[model samples]
Target: MHVRFTLQIFAVALLVSTTAARAGILRVYPGESIQAAIDAANPGDTILVEPGEYYEDAGSIYGLRITTDNLRLIGKSKNSHSHPSDKAGQMSNRVRLIANGAQETGVYVAPAGCEYKNSACAEELQGFYLRGFSVEGYPANGIQTRWVNGFQFVRNVSVNNLNNGIYPTLSANGLVRDNISYGSLDTAMWVAGSENIRVIGNELFGSVIGFEITVSNQVQASHNKIYDNTVGIGLFHPNGAGNPPLPVMENWVIEHNHIYDNNRPNDAPDGSFQADLPPGTGVLLMGVSNHVVGKNRVANNGFVGIGILGWCSATTGTDNSCETRPPISDPAANDNQISLNTLNGNGESPPGGILDFLAADLVYFQLEVTVGAGNCFKNNKPEGLTFVSSAPNGELPSDNC
Candidate 1:
């Protein structure tokens, strides 16, 4: 009986090992392909890339693409060291994924050719972790993820990526932390069509919109330095020439961030969503709901420090109605609370042009299709001066919730 029990135990161990793919480390030194190593690794494996400049654009997809579940792609093993150049990847001690304009994206993580309704595909393709790499000069995004179930984007660098630096769309349950994104033609970090995501502890600059959250739900953005962009931290709901908007863009929290000096010229192409953005706007919440903006230091912006506008007024160029027309995205700011923020030295210099109405410390004047309710800004800095530089008739609420 004792011999039989020992045999049974050994048999169980063997079964367990075979059923679950054994995890291992795959290393790629200089001149080797990181994508090749990733292709060879199993689920739950870690790919360690050595410090060097790599110029591979993994055929038709990206520099590196990840599909295996629980895969961790790490470089340099430490994030304390940073890229020497801020706007472009001049050099770095970490692994550098150089696009050289041949690649559209640096790294992409998604389940390839998987049916959305398949349970097994969902189980097999989830959870990717990327850290410690400098991806630069991509014609498109430096890092892009779509439909990934869970992800951790930590300590990566993106420079001179044209459209977006780090863009995660249609993904869920992700944490984006400790990253640097700069010199994008559009937004630096764009979390669109995703849910349950947090963007924290990053530096975003030299873009049209620094950090933009669009068509998403349940996002928390905090502890970031957002500056030197056309607009800092845009909560937008896209309703034009894209996917269908999420219902109401609900449950967001923006807190404890140092948002200042976002006075850069708008370089986005015409007819783009951010092309009409007024430079020096601190935080613009457009036509979304259920937010708490508190405990942030918003300072030195040239335009409105905290601006709220219905979609119609900002985009349609009409001021009195929320656009009931077709493609009517939820353009009303509803059910938001703004309180206890340090607002100073803002809106002293208004960016001129067509958006001349957007110059103030706090503003809420929607001219088109306005049925917004339960929005108020209270307890901001300088005591009773919250409404001193607001829209006409103090439309930005001081205490009227």
Candidate 2:
């Protein structure tokens, strides 16, 4: 038998092997429409797609629109964890959802007329699972979900999506793991305005922000390889951004990840929120609170590593200062614990137009919104030729909470 048929059989066998095999199983062969299968599927049904390119029959705006809850969409992959540029000739054995220039999103997962922020949403998708596919070339987002309550994305590759690669916005109880995303105008994976989310074991690169936790709460990012982006990871709370700021960005745990060499130029549009990024930045904590950052390997970023600053004080190359437009509330970096991180070979040279004095392995700008309520750093070990660290806007945040 041909290896293709053998792989297909193996994939179907894995699908049916599940003990809780629910409802029914639908198969969409190559050249068949995924949307048709979705339309025909029930709420708890599972759909298996063959290893082929899906481009022509996609919807006008979305390549695949998933509105049903508890739906499982899986793909047959030769090797699920391999990248497209691998030397092995295995790229053709994976399911690929492609979008044309006119398309906006590759996979759009949200209920109809959903506005959970305004309480107008009728239903939120729950228990959705997607696995083992490649989504790319969409203008807006590759895999986008909003108002989703228990969703999981696993072992997927997202590439060259002009905007966000995998974006989970206004969601909760979500897990994004073992995914690869790269080459985006915006963030590779942005967990924005969401809660109870965990982003782990993903590789992100070549975007404005590799992985960002923006105005979110109770989220955690760990064991992800983030590199070659404008900023590796941004923990930001940007105020006056279209809508009212969400609840304080708090209760985050960032550790055990490798963030390095993120020196790409900022690709976000001018005057946008991320446009002011100076590049060579690793794990910036801005206007957030109650975070625990430790035990990560951050190296060779060339500008800063694990910097913590408040809203009004962190500025670079952007002439529009916070003095021009201050926030309603003091969005300071408060009550954070930065400890036990390893930094190496950072801040030999700052990026152009950035203040030369502000670059270091561990930077802390002490713009205290509330007196004595500040971040504390302790037991961080820096290693380099001359140890080009120990420079902060004030004294190192050690022993000063």
Candidate 3:
């Protein structure tokens, strides 16, 4: 039975490889519309856009809308290469997609009648690859993908996008790597309601939040340079409507990232939840569980290096500001592990609201009377590495998780 199952898997893999090999490549030139080529292409086909500035504004909205599945949108430059590293090095020759103030999103990747909340529909839409392009000047998002599976967004540069630079919501099993994203009013890259998504080797700066994992599970953000944002990395569960059915954010592993100097003033739009985030925050984990923050070099921020807090504690007395319907039954942060991180020079001057509560290295605030188990911290390097807690003694138990 095992041998037969293995052979079936091999046969399926071979069929997929054969199909991809047979897929044709469609080329779009400077004057030709990219959407036209995309509409003309079939599934598993490749759209090679030549090196030039392409303005995708269709009367009321902006940029190209991709509804097709298994499509690879690649930029063809003078230095066009297959690998992400080589493409990043030759960014000067990339095919640029400019929104030109008309559109909310530069590239919108979503098919009709299939929202990300439907796991079956999301799983059916697979193999979307976007690479080697510069997406800029969108009012809302640079590249937004909803409910896509097995997607690859690599070697892309997103700048001056208003809300999010690379926002993938309700997606699963994707790779967002080797990207440079900056100048966003909100998060540079936000993975919301996603699972098994890897955001690695990306540079995110000059945004409200460098990287955010919201209501997402099983995400791994590693080796990314996060700096010059209001908050370096944020893991939170907001009280918003229309969120995915996933009730809790869990099992996220953030490791080996350079999180530093995230002191940029909050520039998110007024009335937006992110505008209220405290600046100079290195990593803020609120209302999240079963997460690991390890092996990171967190330094030189004016506020807390790493903050773990419950939902109520983080946003107290803010009427109608948080999600109400979901009713976070247990808002206390629980079962989190922080280990082996290099923390230094944080909380030099904390923000106003949390000034008295700030700690240089790490701070934990649990609003609930009954704390959950297995929140541990250990083996972190020493450079003013203090752990401040809301307990009576202002200390926590030893790390034994």
Candidate 4:
């Protein structure tokens, strides 16, 4: 009996070792192909890439496409002292994935067999983590993900990418934190058609729009520094072409961010919709409701600090080519709250289009034909608040529920 029991224990140990070997780390050194190792890895395996400049011209659409689920692509450092916080050392020790202006995207995470419209589809693909890389010079986006769930994109740098720097579309329950992105032709970081996303502790600059949340729900964006863009932060509805089918942009909380000095000219590609954004606007809310903008330092922007305009008002009188199709049903900016923010030295100079409109610290363009309901601004100090509107309304209500 004692011999039989020992044999059973040994067989169990062998089974455990076999299972561990199946999910092993595949390491790729310099001069080796990173894509080969990724193609060889199973789900739940890690692809560890060594420090080198990898110029794999694999994707004209996207350089590296990750279709498998639960895969981790980590950058392995040879220098023991290199840390992600030390910019110079981190850049030296990073696996630099460069598109060299040839590929459209540096890294594209495309999980299979999922549809974002179904709430239960998030369970189809799980556990994707990308960390510690310098991804740059792509025409479309640095790192983009679609139809992914429970993803983590942290401690990465994206620069000089077109369209967007880090874009996550049709994803759910993701965390995008501790990243630095700049010099994109469009928005630096855009979360579109996603749900339950947390964009925190990131810095974005030198893009047409620093950060944008469009057609997404249950988003919380806080503790970010946004500057040197055409528009610092934008919350927009889905009214234009190529927009998602979602009708409402609601339940968003944008708080405690430093949004200032957005004086850069809009350099987005010609005929793009973002090229219509006025330079030096700090924050723009176009036809989005049930959102909160609180406890932010919005200063030194040339145009209005925060502008709430209807969808038709924003898109109307511009080039007819920049029009939203199917005409939004509810075009009024309603039921939004802007409170407890430090707004100072804003609207120093008005733009050409809004020259006749009052350049105040906060301006709400109330439509003459249809009045929106439950739109209020209060609990902000320093008195002397101004309003720009067709009708003179006194005493905004204090309820910001």
Candidate 5:
């Protein structure tokens, strides 16, 4: 009996080890191709492609496509490292989801419906982690995640001639950290309608717009070094009505960043046709509110460091329940706290101070000030800035240095 018990215990241990080993690691070799591995992946499985050139055919499928939920597409351990440039060999075999008569994003993760209706009834893809990967030369955005939730990107890098380096839309609670994103004709990081996002500790350069956050809420972009781009950070508001109401951009924390040498070569217009004037700033909040801009060092840009344009939209309400309301008929960018920042030694002086109240100083009459009020500006080391506009009309609050 004692001998039988010992044999049973050994059998259990073997079963556990086998289950862990079979969890998921589908390898895609040079000749074997990605489709073979993708076909073998179950839900929660990982597609691991080896380091080799993967020249795809036009009108072909994607490099890594995850229609099921909870899938991970990662590179091999050797390929995911921070090595010297392997421009020709390494990137040549990358997953290119070109628009070569095909209709798909490079790394496409769409909603799992109409296709997988039985075994897994289309769980909203969450925990989709793409790590240690290089995405380049795609037809659309290099890495686009549409209709996903709780996604995380770690140590991923993209370079050389793509649309948007990383485009994420209609997601929630996403995190993008420790990545190098660059060389796009359009916006580098375009995030929309994604809430609870943390964009921290990344390096971005060489794009028309370094980061573009529109109609997003509860976003905190900090500790990232952004430079050598056309526009550092472009925030926009949709004009007029009849479109879907703009979402409120609230509780945003833009801090502890080194942004410089932007607006290089010349002041060129971005995707929105607005030029990113140099000595680029660390943060630019436009028509946004309930934001805290502090601990950032903005300098050496052709334009002003932080420019705030006061505009109103009915949708700017309800990002958070604790926000105070404005008290005017016209729209105003109100209740934003700007403090503990540094701005000095930029190119265009006086007009390009570390912080410039553009809506008040330049385009006050055009802004529609409504029930919003009290935008704060204090404790800032401004090399060339002073209060030019009258204090907020008792409806708005301010503390200037």
Candidate 6:
């Protein structure tokens, strides 16, 4: 029976590869719409679009209304396709795709519109590969996915956009690698409520929300070169009615990243929009738990480096008090481990430090210290670390730093 199960798994993997390879070779023309080809594509098929301009109306090309899984969208040009020589010591060709229409998102992954009900979306899609494509000029997001699994985005690029370069919502087990994401007023990438996801070996520059991960669980973000972003890496929660409160977001690992020179001035007319500042910081963890942020080189942030701010909000509570103090604090945001990070010339602009831990409202504890509050930290090396507590004692000594 064990052997049988193993064989079954192998067979499934083989089927996946077979379908993927078949899908990889199908060529799409200039006159034919990319969406139509994707709609006709079967699972495990590759759709190759030649080098040319393709016009699309709002919404996604593949699996726009219906949820289609296991599809690979690639390019046919040397610039769009993988470079011929692996070790050529040369810049590989880049695929340039121009979007000429208004849409909610450039390339999105979700169930069909028919699946939209009440306030929830269909969650039956998984395993989409979007490569060698350039997406631009979207009304909302560049790429949006929700409730899917096993997505691979490689060697694709986006520019001159309005929203996020890539937005994946409520997904599990995906990868964003070797891509260039830029020229957006909004986030470069925004991921929420995801698990087992990775953002590695990508270049993100010039965006409102660069590398924003909020309300997520069990994610790993590392080894990517992030620069010139307003909020290099952001983690937060959205306010609304009947919103699912954040549960314990656990087992998140952030390591080996080069985050530098992120402090860009906020372009939003309203000062309340804080997502667009290019402050130099590696990781910002709020409303999250069981996270590990280490081995990163962070520098030149306008504000504090590696900030940990715990705030609360209530759905059903006294008027506007929930904005300041929710009836319940997110239990998950507590308890984290941060260590082994290199900080250089950080906090040049304002209240800055290599590390800053700001917590409030739980009146029992004193200030200036972080320990024994159901959270733990050890072996942290920040050039200038500061621990700020609003509680009574309100401050951990420099030793804790």
lDDT of 6 by residue, 37-150 (tens): 787888777888876666664443422332677778886555324432221211234333445544456677766662211247645686888887766666566766777788
What digit string (tens of lDDT, one per residue) describes model 5 on residues 233-295?
Answer: 766443311113344557777788777656644233342233333334434555566777778
Give the per-residue lDDT of model 4 (tens digit) for 140-180. Answer: 78888777888988878887888789888777899999888
lDDT of 6: 0.59
The CA lDDT at 119 in model 2 is: 43
Best by lDDT: 3
The reply for model 4, stretches above 4 Å from the true place, is: 1-22, 58-60, 77-91, 100-102, 112-124, 320-326, 385-401
Query: Which runs of model 5 end up more than 4 angstroms from their true locations?
Result: 1-22, 60-63, 77-104, 113-123, 238-248, 265-282, 311-331, 347-366, 369-372, 382-401
Clash count for each candidate, listed in order shown: 11, 0, 3, 0, 19, 23
Clashes of 1: 11
Location of the lowest summed lDDT over 10 successive residues in candidate 6: 359-368
**lDDT of candidate 1 over 1-401, digit per residue (tens):** 99999999999999889746588889998888888899898888999888888888445547777878889999873343335453233353668888853567888887876432223334335899999888888887889877788899998888888989999877899999999899999889998878999999999988998998888889899999999999998887566324467674687889999999999999888867677778988998877777888889988998878877766666665322234344456566777788888888788888877676567777775554555677778778876443332344655754346
The CA root-mean-square deviation of candidate 2, after full C-alpha superposition on the true structure, stands at 8.0
Tell me the deviation in Å of residue 305 in model 4. 1.1
Q: How many backbone clashes does candidate 3 have?
A: 3
In terms of lDDT, model 4 sits at: 0.78
RMSD of each: 4.6, 8.0, 4.2, 5.2, 7.7, 6.6
lDDT of 2 by residue, 152-200 (tens): 9998888888878999887789999999999888889988778899999
C-alpha lDDT of all candidate models, in order: 0.78, 0.79, 0.80, 0.78, 0.59, 0.59
| Local error of candidate 4 at residue 150 (angstroms) | 1.1
Two-way lDDT contest, 2 vs 5, winner? 2
